[model samples]
Target: MGLNLRAAILHNVTDNDQGQLQDTIVDAISSGEEKMLPGLGVLFEIIWQNSSEADKKEMLETLEQGLKR
Candidate 1:
């Protein structure tokens, strides 16, 4: 069940069958739409809640770098 949930969540990030939604998300994030940061926060919360410590640390570093921009 958890695995399925994880897949579903990540599919939004990884799916490429359609381009617009993913492109929009990327553009919004790159443009620093402050509202979109919370979406990233929610995604991070999901990962942090379920991932191993090493994975969480890796993601934390990535997110920290992104937030620094």
Candidate 2:
């Protein structure tokens, strides 16, 4: 059977509270493991999908500014 990684990642975190989700994200980023990126991308995809147009524009601007550094 093919594993649906995005679905699996979402399922694992579906019941998490805000603090738990924050901790999970912090831990993954702090670990600096390349393996964690796909999971983070999945989470970002969800955030992007749910965000308003203004919110997305803000995010993009912030991302662009950060990339210039």
Clashing pairs in 2: none
Q: Where does the lowest 10-residue lDDT sum fall in candidate 1?
A: 1-10
The regions of model 2 sitting more than 4 angstroms off are none
Task: Tell me the tens digit of each residue's lDDT in model 2 across 1-69.
Answer: 999999999998999999999998999999999999989999999999999999999999999999999
Per-residue alpha-carbon lDDT of model 1 for 1-69, expressed as tens digits? 245655554676655444765575677779897867755665667658999989988988997999999
For the record, the alpha-carbon RMSD of candidate 2 to the native fold, in angstroms, is: 0.6
Best candidate (score: lDDT): 2
Please report the TM-score between candidate 2 and the true structure. 0.96
- RMSD in angstroms between candidate 1 and the native structure over all alpha carbons: 7.0
lDDT of 1: 0.69
Q: Model 1 Cα displacement at 52 (Å)? A: 0.6
